[model samples]
Target: MDKFLKMTGFATSIISWYNINKRDLPWRQNASPYHVWISEIILQQTQVKQGLDYYNRFISLFPDVVSLANASQQDVLLAWQGLGYYSRARNLHAAAHQIVERYNGVMPDTYAELINLSGIGPYTAAAIASIAFGEPHAVVDGNVFRLLARCFSVELPIDTGEGKRFFTNLANELLDSTNPGDFNQAMMELGALVCTPANPDCAICPLRTMCNSYRLGNPFSFPVKSRKTTKRDRYFYYFVHESDKQLAITRREKGDIWQGLWELLLIESDKRLSENQIVRQLSESLNMAPLAVSHVVEMRHLLTHQNIFASLHKVKMPEKFNLVTFKDKIVVYTGRENLTDYPLPKLIEKLLAQYFDLPPKVL
Candidate 1:
């Protein structure tokens, strides 16, 4: 317990640093629950720089739960285009609608109530509760894990259940009740800015003097994790069919990756498909005789647990199939001009940038 209090003292230094040197981000400017909620959702498993634009755009367009709920799913998804993890956007949309219908369009102020929303989990609920509502709850994320592991020299593998339970208890104990939000933010900020994953800046770090890992000259060695994912190689073949100014696309349904977003015709295989197999699959999916395959190219996309080797096949469809009415899975984009208005997965976007004569810096 004495050791715990001593370690928690690091929050003071972290808070001081944060007050002076925190980045002037949009979300930090106003502590609006709506804005904070959107930012938290966007920043999950995404970098700050990348998530910033999406955060601003979402707030500017939606502004509040009512507006977000009233808007169409298509509109919400269009606003969320280019941001990966389509499910986040979908879940956020669902939560917004739920709030409007059930809670009179007002976001709940308590963590317990917020957790009841469809998309929010414990971490998000805690963050919103503390940062937006000033409710006392600890935010224990990866950054906090790094700071805690090194500061206390804990050896429990962070990826294990015991480690998670132990750390959550420790974090709750350390959290400053008076300023739980600021304290939590300060810890995360310290880890992100000074106690980085690689080559941590110990000189500027406030906890350096007291950090057990630093004193042991192996701060990086703490926060040990158990590796669980086994990367599997996959092959994707995308058929790009363009006629006039319109390009063909499809909406990925639920139960598949990149679900609820638009994509090009895709063929997935365990083994890399031969050129003939690619042509045959495209023919079957498109329901057209194999047209002349003009351009065939390959690219690679990396997901967390899988490696995707993608092949882009540019084909001119038969006139009969070219005019085939699009179902939910098939639609036509009116050139790159209207592309931004539709929700598309990153994989499809990458394929478009290559196949279409996209303008400079369109993405």
Candidate 2:
């Protein structure tokens, strides 16, 4: 650390800027542990704009850990609809139940206690401890990592174990003991708003004087990370069985993608399948009677870890064909007017929009 770049000076500069420039996010104003916890989980790997509505709805329905615990998993998944990470919702529900059962509905106030909860990582624990309980623990997340990398011009790869350890220590050193809450927020806010990964606004940055990357005139090159995982592509064949104006759909089972959510009858393939293969699989799986298949639509959806290739087959129900097997084998629907009530992925929603000829509507 530089002589003039101590935590006190860093805290003063960033907090001062944050007081005036911080975005008036709902989570920022609410100090409740439950609300903060929800916001943190929702905001992980998701943008603020996308997570805000879910936060508001979640807080409205399940205001506390008790309420969240009491709610059924289906309801929680319904609330978490369109949010890609299903594991987060599952973990949230688990944590809520744990807090209610073990902690007597009171959220644990310390980092250690909170971190012990399932799915509450170090970043989440530190955030809840400092913001909700006023603990003096340093919160080092992606935003903090970016800020610290540029501040000291750290050369370690942020994706590596040593890089994470180095930045964790650096963040701990820079935390303001007196106001850890505000200092943590300031650090995260500065990275999100000013020292962004792309095209950082160094001229307006409060810590430009002390930022090593700024001094070197290359603010975007620090905090290098290596990519280890390659994205795998998946192909899905969805059968939209419209009968008397109702669209048939079913809920996905446990231990699968989009688990416990309503979806059209699907046939997933290891690789992108041809049109004939898709039709054969759909017919065999659904046990659909002899019928005429109309337009086959294809759509591609991109996820963080995998590429989703969807092919929608519109099968017009035969008026007199045998219906006992299809009805008993799967849940059939007659319309899609109230489809939004059920939990669904954003990709599925996108496919639905095109399938039903309906434009996208914000939830």
Best by lDDT: 2
- Which residue pairs overlap in candidate 2's backbone? 245-334, 246-334, 246-335
- CA deviation > 4 Å runs, candidate 2: 2-7, 288-290, 320-334
lDDT of 2 at 198: 88
Q: Which one is best on TM-score?
A: 1
Q: What does candidate 1's lDDT look like per residue over 1-363, in tens digits?
A: 466566655667778788887888898898888888999899887888898988888998999999998888889888887777778888999999889888899999999999999889988999999999999889888898999898888889998999998888888888888888888778877878888899799888887777888788998797898877799998877777777757777677889677777777677899977778777776676666665875566778888878988878887766645634433265654576777776877777777777665642383
**Candidate 2 per-residue C-alpha lDDT over 59-115 given as tens digits, one digit per residue, 9 for 90 to 100:** 999988989999998889989987877889988999998998889999998998999
TM-score of 2: 0.92
Error in Å for residue 170 of model 1: 0.8
lDDT of 2: 0.82
Q: What is the lDDT of residue 193 in candidate 1?
A: 84
